[model samples]
Target: MLHTDAPGNTRQNGRWSSIVLIVKMLLTVAWRNLLRNRRRSVIVFISIVVGITAVMFNDGLSIGMISQMLENSIGSHVSHIQIHAKGFNDNRVIQNNMATPSEVENVLRDTPGIAHWSPRVVSFGLLSSALNSSGGVIVGVDPEREQDVTTIRRSIVEGSYLTGAPREVVIARRLADKLQVGLGDKVVGMASALSGDVGSDLFRVTGIFETVSSEFDKAYMFTSIDNARSMLELEDRVLEYAVIVRDINEVEDIAASLRSKLGDEYEVLTYIDLLPILVSQVDMYQSMMYVVYLIIALAMIFGIINTMLMSVFERIQEFGVLMAIGMRVRRIFLMVLLEAGMLGVLGTAVGLLLGSGLLLLFSHIGIDFSIFSEGLTSFGVGAVIYPRLTPDTILNVLIIIPLTTVLGAVYPAVRAMRLQPVAAIRYV
Candidate 1:
């Protein structure tokens, strides 16, 4: 071999080494330039910090609201999944009930992820007290099983939960108020029986429960499955089955499994399906955040541009001297860009630290917005909100802040590059 390629490799390595040295020099010069204008740099740095912190805190509040809504809705009544007769979700009539309930019960029992399941006789009816009458949905449940799947027992504000006693009913606080009834008050429930006639029964109000939702409170009444069966003239059939799973994150998989096992006769629905509006709200929130990020980025871009432009104007003569001594125009441009990059990197790092700290603190202590309690309750959310720092929000900030700073530096960097060395050096 001639070994001629050895010189070529050596020259390539030398060129790469030269590039690295030039980069190191440019970084040092950029850093020194930033230090020369500490006040302006600090001002821009503080703006970024404040902006990032505000955005993070706002996003955290939204996440907390959506999380609370989901928890309250699921804990109150929806459960993790619901199994209904094929037409029951749409029609919800006495005729549209599960005929062979034993098979569904068996599947629920054998399913590994199912924690608890409760059967319900759901029917629309008129509930009347001695004082007044109101229309609501009647839910017949097994007292003990319902306790495991729903928070109705814990939500009892007054009186007692169902004890398998005959004709005992649990009414919501709003319904109670509407009917001018309280615990122990006698109420009449009327519904359409399977015999093509109206069926009616007398019940004693045993408990009054108040959840976060006023609508849910006013719209539903709970009674023993036996009493409901007796009044409705039904056999051992059920209209719906509410199921709770061991883990909520696995609900979609569990629902799919249940659907496969149960076949087409039954409808397997998850909380996501039951509460579509809430799911939409969560998605809408994420979409709306992009608009918020745009606003913040725009503000940051302008701030960086004003600061960097001022720095460039002040250093016009200095740039002229460097270029006069044979510094390339591209090197001047790269130096300006490096200065902006430094600002972005430093500001973003500090901002993330402070923002993340605040999120962690609020996640533990929570923020009280009880002043808006009435409004929050209407949406099935709690008064206290715990801020969470999600990975997506952090990733967006890490990308946006630095990109905004660099984009802002473009005009100033170009202006520095266009300087005529002789004319700039002679300027006052």
Candidate 2:
């Protein structure tokens, strides 16, 4: 038993040692082959670098736009989540208002992830200045509490936010311009009161705000909660509760918790639900990225195949000599694959470094698309976008490079393996 075990162990060790030697030889040959044709190798490397850089830059831009859209939406008014009375979003009537705002506030205060919240009274109404009138959504909010949930206070470009004074209001700059109104100017608001009567009131424009979305700027206005209650005759009632979470990632979970706690009377919605157009835009961009990747992969595959095929043809005599000198057909195939693999490794490494460096540099300075500012602002995205590189993007690139290399080598490797030593050696 001892003798038999010794022989088996020796055979296994020899097999492993043979594998190690073959790998070392293949690597050495591969490295030499790549260096032999410097111009061809450089061309292939440049193609890979360009392809990778384009993909990374484009991906960063897309991500940046999406990030900015989300930030602007959250800062403008959407917050992370909103709790509204059932069917309130569909029909913005006084009847659909939240009756127990105090109870909702208590629940929000008790919630673990709730960072800040503000109760709002939302109403669609006709707003008019002395010279012009336009239809707009009137938002009533607590001066101090609203600051934590929205950036309305910070977005005030002129004058100041609602100071809790009776009849004080804030208008977006676009709306203010359309109405020909400015600071301390009076704007009349007309909306349906709880009694089904047309409630009208005069409010002094205390502030003018400018947000990313021009449409939002023109369609929304704000006033103190008390004044809104008086104008809409909604005593102590609110339309919704805007909530900001401590962590944006935890928004869905917190919304679920709030839904379960609040029961069926209230409907909790995340920004994704509230802003379906934005969600769709993000999804569309993500889908487009896959198509872009496919195109890039095809370009890379063709480039590699062309380079490897050329290398195989040029080294035909060498492969014939190696095979004639007792190297196996499988080894020849492996050598061809190794050469292609090495090229891919070197190119991809350099490309990744270059792309990552560019992304890092641009992330700080940001890309200014001020030329398309009007179009971007219409979609709630800012002109200056800060590029972002996610872990997923890096992972995708890593996985694609090796797979592309292997795919590109298969035909060339197979061609090398099928070569008859005598025929290959005799060929001109």
Candidate 3:
């Protein structure tokens, strides 16, 4: 018999091997079985969809809410990056650090990967309007370019961005309200230098800017860096550096790179670093997302295991017949697993659709939490929460849903395959 067998056919024979063919056959069988019980398949589909929708939308909205607040906090006043005097971070007092606008501007303009650069001077002072005076912080910025980097463009509610060092300024809506001044009002900014030699005498109100973060919105005043320099008696110098980048994703990369390149002489800080609370918050959300996915995956696994067990009990004769017809018990077990896998695939698809739908809807209209702002004062989170969408979160759900379903079916599948042929065949 060996002598008669074709001599060079082994390589060709291996191409049509039993295991490969078995998988194909098993998948086909699983598909047929699934279609045989359309109602059950549909139930599993609905469960997966519900789970995914809740997870995706809840996370998305949560992200958006935080993103909105962060934008208001970071984007409006703080540029993406700030280079300051090495020891100045601990004491952000105005006099301790200074950079010349034109000097820094020349270096920044030539620096690759930067979008825009600005020299800013920050000071805490008393803002006196025509009739009333309110305490606030004064922020000196370039009027025209301020719009390019932040949410400031939409925040000017009453008048206009300061123009041409008009002694003109933009105050927060809260400060404007507290000061009882609207458009075309003059406010005095009073800040004394460390030696009491330099101080802000006065400024005219050009506009009132509104934002979700009342802290910055109420206290901040925008003026031309020139006007700010003049008022503070700071000629040709700035308190710190403000830089924007090409993308938000590159923040940490840029921060790290800047730290290395700029070295220890200057402190390079990202907008995220400037506000530690927000960075901590985003980290907390990410940690919680992991826990959520784990819980949801375990729950989904249980659902799948239960469904598969039910199917095994319901189809004992089918297994007996397969065994009786010479189909290996291992193949029978594998087929059951394939069925579970198929369910997972279908469920994942449905979940993604529902999750995407929820994301789209929330992205547009926003989730309003304005009614709860008073209570939220405790957490420092705004009352109206917005959910933002990102690819990482979406990818998480994509990886989890099917993995849960497949893992859940493992035990039940093994039990089904191990059934004694006589017992399974004798089931009444």
Best by TM-score: 2
Tens digit of per-residue lDDT, candidate 3, span 333-405: 7898899888888877888887887788767776667787654433444566656668987788778887788
**Candidate 2 lDDT:** 0.88
The lDDT per prediction is 0.90, 0.88, 0.76
Candidate 2 at residue 228, lDDT? 90
RMSD of 3: 4.2
Candidates sorted by TM-score, descending order?
A: 2, 1, 3
Name the runs in model 1 displaced over 4 angstroms: 1-17
Native-structure RMSD, model 1: 4.4
Between candidates 1 and 2, which one is better according to TM-score?
2
Candidate 3 has its poorest 10 consecutive residues by lDDT at 374-383
**Using Cα atoms with residue i matched to residue i, what is each candidate's TM-score against the true structure?**
0.91, 0.94, 0.87
Residue range 76-158, candidate 2, lDDT tens digits? 99989999999887776888988888878889999999999999988898999999999998999999999988989999999
Q: Which candidate is the best by lDDT?
A: 1
Per-candidate clashes, comma-separated: 0, 0, 9
Model 1 lDDT-worst window of ten? 4-13
Per-residue lDDT of model 1, residues 1-428, tens digit only: 56867756555547889789889999999999898988988898889889998998888888878888988899888999999989777887899888888999999998898999999998899998888998998899999999999999999999999999999999999999999998899999999987768989999999999998777888889999989988998778898899999999899999999999999999999999999999999999989888898999999888888888999999899999999999999999999988998898888888888888999899999999889988888898867888888898789889998999989998899999999998889867
